[model samples]
Target: MTYIDQLGASAKQSAKVIATLSTATKNKILVAVAEELLKSEEEILTANAKDLELACSKGKKPAYVDRLALTSERIIAMAEGVREIATASDPIGIIDTGWLHPKGMEIIQKRVPLGVIGMIFESRPNVTIDAAALAIKAGNAIILRGGSDAIYSNTMLKNIFVRAGIAAGMPPASVQLVEQTERAHVRELISLNNYIDVIIPRGGKGLKSFIIEHATVPVIETGAGNCHLYVEKSADLEKAYAIILNAKTQRPATCNTIETLLLDYELLVAFLPIIAQKLADAGVVLAVDLTCMEILNKHKIIAEHATSADYKTEYQALKITIVAVGGVEDAINHINTYGSGHSEAILTEKMAASDLFAQEVDASSVYINASTRFTDGAEFGFGGEIGISTQKLHARGPMGLRALTTYKYIIRGNGQIR
Candidate 1:
């Protein structure tokens, strides 16, 4: 049989074992896994070095290799993330709702595991640990398909997890990795919807769009962030400038980085130039609307006239497009129209406007007077995450253990005539 066929069979059997395993058992496995990660950090780093060397030799960009590389600090971070997730309340079997019918029938809507999750992601090698920990803790088995760039590192990581699981008296097959990193293998795995309960593609737009288009399995499409931050009329100038700079420049390669800034007309005259100058000093390229361009040009802040295309762009760099909106409503409309529904924030002193913006903006997380960069699973108290879900279907926000589950109706009834 093909490797895909063998993987599908193992995953199907592992799901049954995991679904019946107690939470305590899962936590034990997590603790052992964490211990293993710490013990093997040097070996993991050695494996990561090979990937880094290959990436550098292939002339891959620095940013790409940086994401592909792992260090002892990052390995410890991943291990600590596992411990945090293990401490989280078990999401499985939680009764969401219950009701009793007039005919002496009791019904319970309880959360259950998704059985087997086929997770395909890129760049970040730490996802191997995070995804495996979350899935096992939530009583689900997983099959991981990490990017070819991180293949060696992830393979070693997955081996550690399996060894830890088996040593902790858990089924090692509860976590599996696709040994084959070919594109065709991923397509084959995605096609096995009957064995794999769900397909979660966590990467950039290209991979997400490809999976959504081709995969028959139900997909949790993740990450296409053109996030925005609007500085409203009543926004504090200092706060707006600080938040904008931090959101746009702090880890600009991330999906939560602010791609656009909306400046309200009332504050445009006073606040625009000040913020523009600060950003210029920090070496941020400004794509400014006509009003902002006029203000910046007068103040000797280097900027260019922003086009409509700028609003739709997700520049994963130290660049941001600035636009002057008529009011809060216009800003909201702009975000809803062009934003990628990932993370949106507004800095405003007006409580009512902040509330309205938070409610109206269609995003996984909306912030008031806070940076959009806070829209992360760790920030949301989930420890770590696989990715942020941009779609509104199954998972809508930072995908933690709860988001990895579906519910079933656990009904109990006595023998009685209807």
Candidate 2:
């Protein structure tokens, strides 16, 4: 058998033990892991240094190298994130519903573990702590397959976390890491349906699509937020300026970063120039539709001509596409058809329009007056997330500890016949 197959078998066996573990024990393990991460900061940093050196030699961008470089401060933050996850409410055994049958049986549906989870993520060693924390807290074993870019960092962090769990009286196998960063290894892991109960793909569209198309395992596809920021007719112009700037430039590498700006036609004469000019001034490439283009040129606000493909692009860069919609309904239609079905927001003071947009948009998290960046597990008060699930089945939005769980029916009867 292959190495992945062997790892899968071990994880499957360990998952049986994890599923039956109590919340207290899980939290104990989490707390210990956090403490260990703090104690082992030097070791972790040393490992991260290797990754940084290698990344620099390979000519990786500064931003990319920064992601791989874990400083002392960042290590503490990661530990605290894990500790915060430990303190979140336990998701297991929550009674979804309980009812009595006329035939004299007590039927209760309770949350249960989801068994082993396979998580594929890109460079971000902090995800190592977050994934392991959430998986253990939710009573599920997880196998991490992180990007080769942060190989040394991930390897060291995973060792610390798993060792800490083991020292804290949890099975060490419960938290597994695929040390190999080969693309073939990722494909193999995603394809292991029998052992991995669910797969959480946590990167760009390319990674999510790869798992979606090839994985026989159930997947929670995350992060293809080709998100939007719509400026309504009654929107406060200052609010519009601040919101759009924060959404696009706050962090462009993130999935929730706004890729499109939809303006209500009624506001075109009044607010388009103000919003467009600010974005352009900030070095944001504005891809404008023909209607908006005419207005921009008339006002001498330069912009790039938006093509059909522009609307569909997830520009994880300093860029945004501008489109003019007739009204709220047109805005909703444009979002529903072209959105990646992640997060979409409407900047409207009109309660009715906001309500309608929130109700009609079919994303995991629909925003009324908030930025799409708020579409995160930690922001939703779940501590930290595995990632944002754009898929509709198992979980949606930022997948917290609870999203990693499944439900089971528990029935009780006193020698009753069926």
Candidate 3:
């Protein structure tokens, strides 16, 4: 058999063994893996250094490098995240609902593993542990295909997991990483319909699009964040400023960061200048529509003219698009048109406006009087997420242990027939 075919068969076989493991066994394995990760910090850093050196040699952008690089603190946090997952309640084998049938039968729905998961993500080495820990907790085996830029880090982390997990009595091949970094491997991995139950792709539009077009197996779509932050006319200026600053500048490379700023026309003249200066102070470049540009010009603030494409872009950098809208309705319309359906937030004091925005915005996560950055799995108390799903089919929002599970029907009958 070919390389990917062998990986697929191994994962498929491992899934059955993992699915039968008790919750305590899974938790024990996860905790062991976490401890091993902490103990192997130096080795992990050495591997990450190699990847970083290659990324730097290729002249990768700072944001890209930041995502690929790993520090001691980050490794600590990664370990802690795994421990948290161990602490989370296991979802497997829990009865969701039950009913007695009129025909003398008992029907019950129980949560079960999705069998095997195929993860295709970008250059974030921490995801290696998060995905494996979550999949094991949810009683599923996983096959990981991380980006080429993070191959060294990913391989090292996966090796640690496999070693620790097996030592802790977990089944072999419970977590497997694709060593091949070639583009064709992605297609082959996703196309393993008989082996992989579901494919989760976490990356840019290009990667997601390729999987959607090529994969024969099921997929859960994680989206790009062309997220927006709208300031209603009745918003508290200080609160709005703080929320926007945190959402845009705190970690602009994240998928949940705001890419667009929408201002109520009535509040535009008053609030725009303050936020513009604050973002500028943080080295954020602004691309503004005509109305916003005119106001910024009066205040001697410089900005680039925003193109139609700018509104639809996920900057993933220290840049934002600014626009003036008539009111909540107009803001919602613009967001629905340009937003990526990931995360959207509104800073407003009026309960009515907040309610309207929360109810009307088409996104996986909507926030009021808060930063969009809080749309994280850990922040939502899921330990760590496999991905933040934007599609509405199987899962949505920050996918935790439960999101990785599906349900099966169990029926009991005492010789009762139709």
Model 2: runs farther than 4 Å from truth?
56-69
Model 1 Cα shift for residue 163 (angstroms): 0.8
Choose the strongest candidate by TM-score.
Answer: 3
User: Per-residue alpha-carbon lDDT of model 2 for 1-418, expressed as tens digits?
Assistant: 8989988999999999998888889989999999999999889988888888888999987556666779899989888898899889998989999999888899999999999999899878889889999999998888999988888889989999888899887886898889977799888998898899988888767888888899988887888989988888888777778888989988877888899999988888878898888888988889999999999999999899999899999988888999999898999999998998889999989999999999998788887777888887888999999988887887888999889898999999888885
Once superposed on the true structure, which residue ranges of model 1 sit more than 4 Å away at CA? none
Instruction: Tell me how far candidate 2 lies from the true structure as C-alpha RMSD in angstroms.
Output: 1.7
| lDDT by candidate, in order shown | 0.89, 0.88, 0.94
Question: What TM-score does each of the candidates earn?
Answer: 0.97, 0.95, 0.99
What's model 2's overall lDDT?
0.88
Backbone atom clashes (below 3 Å) for every candidate: 0, 0, 0
| Displacement of the residue 232 alpha carbon in candidate 2, Å | 1.1
- Order the candidates by lDDT, highest first — what do you get? 3, 1, 2
Candidate 2 positional error at 119, Å? 0.7
Question: Candidate 1 lDDT, tens digit per residue, 305-341?
Answer: 8888999988878789999998889999999999999
Question: TM-score of model 1 relative to the true fold?
Answer: 0.97
Clashes of 3: 0
lDDT of 3 by residue, 27-116 (tens): 999999999999999999999999999999999999999999999999999999999999999999899999999998999999999999
